[model samples]
Target chain A: MAALGREKMKQLEAQYKKILADYIVNQTEKNLYIAQNFTRQLIQKNISPEDVISIHKNAIAEIFPDRMNEAQPAYDFLIEVMVHYGMAHREHQSLLQKQAEYEMEMKIATSIQKALLKTHIPKLSTVDIGMLSVPARKMNGDYVHFFYHRDDYLSVAVTDVVGKGVPAALCMSMVKYGLETLEYAYKEPSYVLEVINRVIEKGVDDSMFVSMFYGCLDTQRNMFSYASAGHEPALHYNAKQDQFVALEAKGLLLGVLPNTKYTYQEVILEDNDIITMMTDGVTEFRGNDHLNSRQIITSVIRDNKYLSAQQLCQLLYREIEKIHGFDLSDDFTVVILKK
Target chain B: MASKSSVEIITEWDIVAARQLGRNEAKALGFGTVDQARITTAISELARNIYLYANIGRIEIERVDTETEKKIVVTATDQGPGIHDIRKVMEEGYSTSGGVGAGLPGVKRLMDSLEVQSVIGEGTTIRAEKWLR
Candidate 1:
């Protein structure tokens, strides 16, 4: 739309006509500068290019009556050019408006997604926790949900949806609500995983699938129970023996089958023992060429074993980011619980 | 059965040929009978898409063995007018309006992982991988 109203446009048009007539007489640099200023004013008024050409023709006809026949055809050709230019200018403005609308929607979506899987890390006197999830794009495919109701136990799950962007984000919301409906600590990790699996299979698309590692920590008993649905192997650091071992279980990725059974496993959490879980986006960060991403991730944890749980997660993420040149190919997530 | 095979798709017979190659590749890669069925169905869907849209393309079947996993990877490539909106087409209930076709999402369902790369005027290449569990 034109920046100026009808009266202002008419006043500017008269001013431009005077400026053009003066520039025609002298052709001085100062006159050229004045003409440039008129062009800017006309643009600010939202005067189309063709409208400028029309005003030029009127100025010429009023200034030189006998010279009209010679310049009329030339002005007509320029009017045709300006007509084409006007269409292109409007198209560009329309495209910019659409871009702004799309970006605004994406920003709103990002905030909604953040609220969908709100992970509140609990502060327990027995176990310290650290976690982080960074989406490569505006929408996140990887999510970490924490459930801590009783002072005696904490239940958590690290899940990754195979599909990316919006679809994956939506799928994760279904998982969060499903997990919430169940009573915590009383239900085994396997049951929680199976319920989420059934929920995803029924609600999501056939093409969509999810991988998850569900774990529950019993602080008073010093026990850790867990299950996996084709997710990445969680690493365990045995403080007493000073060793690292991968915690793995056999099960299909969720949403692939209606009643896929997941295997449940448990380990006693000795003093200062730590359990680290993550999605493929974290373990497969180095990609195909690097065969030992699991080893590298484990070593990072062992080397930085003394740091706080949260600090360990941040350091591991930074280390992976630095090695991968800061451009993560997928949604990255990490969660660690130290007892 | 070859570890890798490429089938040039031009006629309906080519779709059958690719399916045969997919079964053989699946068996050779140590996939069970149920997995073989899944692999062939995925192959059929991808081949049909190439035939319907790509007209003439190539379907490559390969057995990939990595340190951590073994998988059957199928790739369909063509130099044709590519897909305009890949994300829209991949969504559920999105079928090409013209006629009957299995669509790309079906291929994704039958396989373990699917990756599609399409340039509007350049070409399209789709790769589907099914890991042996």
Candidate 2:
């Protein structure tokens, strides 16, 4: 009877040690299964690391009060891992907030740029005008303005700044204001360009400059006088000859010199003559073949000479889009005046 | 040591590209924000001049590190009408075009060193460098 009692006491002691070891190491089959579910619930409830550590301490104290003091290193490792996770979570949350703020700002900027680009082509009996502007990004750097002066002449200007995004858009608004305010100063294209250069030179930054082509069309005499300020050569289509000739003029870009000289050239418009002024974006299209975009432009105008001004502009845009697979590399703007 | 990248300036978009590439190069060379902005602005001015005068050009950015310091060198070249009077073009208020007359001079002020070479009717090339402080 004594031997049997001793064996039973030994068995009970062994079982107690096994339970304490499992609680310390957290490595028994039953303990591991329970812990997996418990940890998932803890994470789902968003329990902080501090609360989790305290809960673990209390559980260990309740089961094996004497062994709780021995699990210090294991507890420290768990705390370290939890702290790292918390930091990463906070960083992710802040990143998300920053992204949302950036998106909102971009949305507002896009709307403002859209509002500035809103322009309508004037209706006239002597000539038909068509214009289109497309931004490569959310904002554009190309600008076009038209003024119907005193029912005798129509003035049109196309300008492209050497930057993009918000700065370029802001500069475009300044160009618009300069054009509007200086329309009454002179009816000559060269004089108008000089005035605009002075205004922009005073207002704009040194790094920014504008390339522009401004032209005035006399309704009664069918005469066109235009000036170029480092802009792309405007194409003049001779209807009688069925040939496209570039109206090349020499001048410096605007906002570069305070008092620069701009020279103007005169052309007599004939029946069914078409004049197209465009930014470099139209001619510099790069695609599968770097298609001679200028050639395509001239040919399109030649083929569609019978169409109305609006239709011709649409056809030209569509042809260019086809060549580029609808992926424009830069901002595109074109103004067409047909008589 | 030298690490180099080149951007083609054919239009306004190319000007932006040149600026971005320059800024990236400056950043890679451990330049601070102000230095990077200065490098980019200088690149913009040079590239814009090329586009305005030459119609097409290339901007090359290089990172150079010597035993003592690191530096970024930017070179803009064009095969268009070369400068007739280099001194006049570099003057702050003298411009052939109706510009603010700040292209070359502003670039000179923003950079540590500037070298301009041109031959009439051949082309123009401008090299500007900024040393990391």
Candidate 3:
């Protein structure tokens, strides 16, 4: 019995040594590679090395789920390495947990932000809306849209929140809510903006404001009513004349002051009239030279008047991408209303 | 309105994915040539926020048809610390970071219609609608 026991112990020892040696010599290097990458990310984020190790462990578990059950040994070894690297394991875990939490929150916020967009534009009978937008990073400041009530009566607006991250997103939500709440009270372009401005001032602080364009389209009347709040001008394309004109209306940005009144300007639409409303993302898009986004937008509209709204938007984006070579520096958005 | 139409993804504040998702949703709506780009832009901005602030979130896209209309509604939900003052958050230039603060408010200003509900420390829900006509 004793001989058998001794032999059994020897076999177990051999197996353990083999696995340990393989891990130390081969697996350890791979783990170190992953660790190094994770460390880079943490350092870039200004997180401590201990926190880096924790994120590394958590990330490893996720990427290699098959080995999650066996992660305890790996984690122990990581803890030892962290100590050698002059990091406190306990503090690192706490920081890692916090960082993980922050990352989770940002993910949740992005999901929420995506939800704010439309999966499909509502099909309308008389008016068609074509829109395109590219956000810079996860959350951007540019916003644009088309609101069609019926027939030729359409409302469109584009806004840029003053920032890029969470605060801007929150402010954007407020603007959305304010518009929904105040829309019924003010249907005219200027009135709607006036009410929105007041609501925003009441809700917002001095640091935040919205630069936007609000418009009401009368398809039956073949006219439009528009208001601007320190936003970019709407471009009007005349297919007959083969020309593009900018409709500029100057007003204070939303949330800047209470009871700020906005003025509306009128534009008549002819057959095959193309109207484009865009955010600053387009105007500010950097090309090899200073690519006037407005000029490119107008040209695209003139070139692709036959395409449908969605196609036109895509074509414009492709062109912009082509002009810049690749990638946009800002949140590029466009709203095209065809008559 | 159905569950199958929705999907969730995770990223580190990736603006490109947000834009792609917006275009994908528009494509799903069969808005191939029409002007759904503006609505997509609005959605992109809102989703970007979820990545920038919450760091983690869930996005839902559904083909919703009411008695009178058929459109797509996307909702981005977040469970971060939550906005302490939603009103303040909506103001442009009122950013905690140095960036221009045009994310959610800008989205609202873009969509056909928008709805927002938030509770501090709980989470936030943003709903935006786009018309197909």
Candidate 4:
């Protein structure tokens, strides 16, 4: 078997000598295509890459009898490097394939995440409402929903799941269905959180948890009733007192405990008063993982008191833009109600 | 960054919304591509984290034990004005004024047992342990 392999190798070397002579002569712009095509056949003959160097030297010597020392060790070294070049080229080709595949996946994920989280902000004449939600990264873990329970009440829920990506999105879809099922119960903030907690606890993985702030605005009564489940506090800007109030509530995080109950609180909105609901992504300036002073959100609202609700949302986002820039570290969300 | 003319990547993605937030930054910086703006954003974020957490909080990792099991525990401590009566918000039956509960109950269930101890003006220590079956 070994002798037969050697004879075949010798025969291939002779064949390569003839092929290399042809390959070099055909290395012109006009004959480049034919040269490459002929070389492909020579390569397909199972000649070892190292053997090509020796074969090339012999071929060069045979083609140019007087050009003796032209095929030296330098030529041998360069041809050996060509072996590496071919391997590297193949590796590069596969990498480009993987990159294209990844980019395609990212585009798909980005769009799906967008469609899942998309919702319309209602425009009301009596009250101007503005909202902004931005992901710190490509995937958003924050969830917001606005439900109009009746002609007089609009309920907004701001939720932030503990994790990110598809899992968090899956949790969000569950919460969405949970909220939708209790459309009639949107009037009460505590009950809304309670139902969401039950749904999350039952439907979501035990390892996951989410913080939520549910607020219902009674437009006719000018009352803002809200509840929270391990979420950030909503700020109340009293246009009268010229100060900000934190509407704080406490309850177990959704998916944390089954049969957990939440606390409800209500505040009457004086004319020109503002209620800002948000997730820790806004954190009223506390930041998602930091303990920033609550002054940041209030100061923006106070300084831009005359701006429309939409502008307020934009300005708050801009301010967060200052903290986070375009690549947010966490999903920053905010909803503003101006009366 | 306003993405006036977006790259032909994702179809029907928010065009106006995708406005060159990068170009916006690039425009602010005078000139550059979105990639350069991203590089700047990354460095700036690192600088921001250094500024924010320079002297703020710490994580204490230790081996802990409960009545039923042995486990490892992590306690994160932050030195700042604790936000609005957070201790009361953690009380079992007490309802938070308007903020979310401190998430103590969920912590309790995830761990085999959980213990919380705090001192007004001093600190709050939350300890929880998981039973390794």
Per-residue lDDT of model 4, residues A95-140, tens digit only: 5677899889988987987887786887666677888888776778
At residue A285, what lDDT does model 1 achieve?
A: 53
Per-candidate TM-score against the hidden true structure: 0.66, 0.59, 0.54, 0.56
Interface RMSD of 1: 24.8
User: Which prediction has the highest lDDT against the true structure?
Assistant: 1
- Candidate 2 CAPRI category: incorrect
Models, CA RMSD each: 21.9, 22.2, 23.7, 25.5
In candidate 4, which residue ranges exceed 4 Å CA deviation? Answer: A1-96, A284-293, B1-133
**What is the fnat value (0 to 1) for candidate 3?**
0.00
lDDT per residue for candidate 2 within A136-193, as digits (tens), equals 8888999888888656788889899988888889888888888878747546899989
In angstroms and one decimal each, the interface RMSD of every candidate reads 24.8, 20.8, 20.7, 24.6
Model 1 residue A159 distance off true place after TM-score fit, in angstroms: 1.4
Model 1 chain A poorest 10 in a row by lDDT: A1-10
lDDT of 3 by residue, A1-339 (tens): 111243443453343344444555678776666545644644454443333344455545545679878885777456434432322332344457778888999999888877784323656676667887778778766665555665646777778887777777778877776676754543488887887788778888789988889887787887877899988898888878888889999899888879788899998888788888888767676545566666777777887899987788788878876776677777777788777
Q: Which CAPRI tier for candidate 4?
A: incorrect
**What is the TM-score of each candidate's chain B when compared with the real chain B?**
0.90, 0.91, 0.74, 0.39
DockQ values of all predictions: 0.01, 0.01, 0.01, 0.01
lDDT to native, each model: 0.81, 0.79, 0.67, 0.64
Ranking by lDDT: 1, 2, 3, 4
Off by over 4 Å in 2: A1-72, A81-85, A287-290, B1-133
| lDDT tens per residue, model 4, B1-133 | 1112212112223222222332243344332221222222222221222223322333333433445643434343444333346556544433212222243433343234556554444444444443323
lDDT of 1 at B4: 79
